[model samples]
Target: MDEDNIQDDIRIYTERRWLRFSSGSYFPVYVLLAASYLLILIYFTIGLFKVFPCGPDTRQWEYFYGKCYYFSLETASWMQAKARCEEKLSQLVVINNTAEQNFIQTRTRNDRYWMGLTDRDREGTWRWVDGSDYNTGFMHWKPGEPNNDGHGEDCAHVWGNGEWNDVYCTYFCYYICEKPLPIRIKGHHNRALSVP
Candidate 1:
């Protein structure tokens, strides 16, 4: 081949070799960047799942409508029942609706249990243990009820018939405790993420 042609061929070969080397050198960097991005996405997804966990599993408590309930096997007076619930990071069960009352009735199953309602602070003015007024919500009082009978019945209890009755605060009876259920984000295959 002529001298000029030979030089041109050598130059083209050198250029191709340099291009290949440069591209090869950058391939690992691109892969590393892609890998880092994927890892970050995975981490954020895991964190999101953690923040919005699935349903709570109380083990001993029953779950219903975003709340967990515990029925005391033993009996206690109103004050003692309140203390017991507080110790467990819960409070006396507050009935908010017919569904809740039904649930409690089913759970208690003809057993008398102390409720969270009371008018001890003022006659005829009922309030929940959580300090919320109870004059406006669903009340399941029994017939001729809340007569403040004997002028001393201040605390409330659930009867076996799913009705409520006001009794003396010192009366001993079974009680129910309630707490907010942990956030549970539902997932496939019946999996749920539970928040701590």
Candidate 2:
């Protein structure tokens, strides 16, 4: 071939090669990178679940809705019950919904049980021990109840009929403990990240 023709062909080839690089020819590379990251995310998510459990491993505790519950037949005053739950690395049950309330009520229908609810911080303004608001979600207080009757009732409890009432903090009663889980696996910056 002539020198000029050869030179023109080379320039055209180089331009086409540059266009290929800057155009959709690299779509596979982009797709591949995205797939790799997505796979990584999936792996870590599944690994987190497999590496840790939703609740403590024991027969006494029942797992429900990412929480663990323990019912105590032994009775104690409201304050003592609260402390007891904390001692076991849990807190008094906070019924967040009708389903959860039903669950605890079914278990404690035979006797009164202290719950993690009280207006002790401010009278007439109840709140759960775990910082959950009292008035935000499901609450099963009896009609005309929490009048702070008598000397004043600052604690909450479930009755035999599954209704709720406020009684004196010193009142002794059975108690239920609750612990929400996917517990921290330790060694991370306080974030619930799974490492495997």
In model 2, pairs of residues that clash are none
TM-score of 1: 0.64
Clashes of each: 7, 0
lDDT of 2 by residue, 171-192 (tens): 8889998877635665652354
Cα lDDT of model 1 by residue, 78-164, tens digit: 999999988877889999999999999988888889988988998888999877658778888899898887859999999858899
Worst 10 residues of 2 by lDDT: 187-196
Error of 2 at 41 (Å): 28
lDDT of 2: 0.81
Residue pairs in steric clash, candidate 1?
53-184, 53-185, 53-193, 54-184, 54-185, 54-193, 55-184
Runs off by more than 4 Å, candidate 1:
1-57, 183-196
Give the top-scoring candidate (lDDT): 1
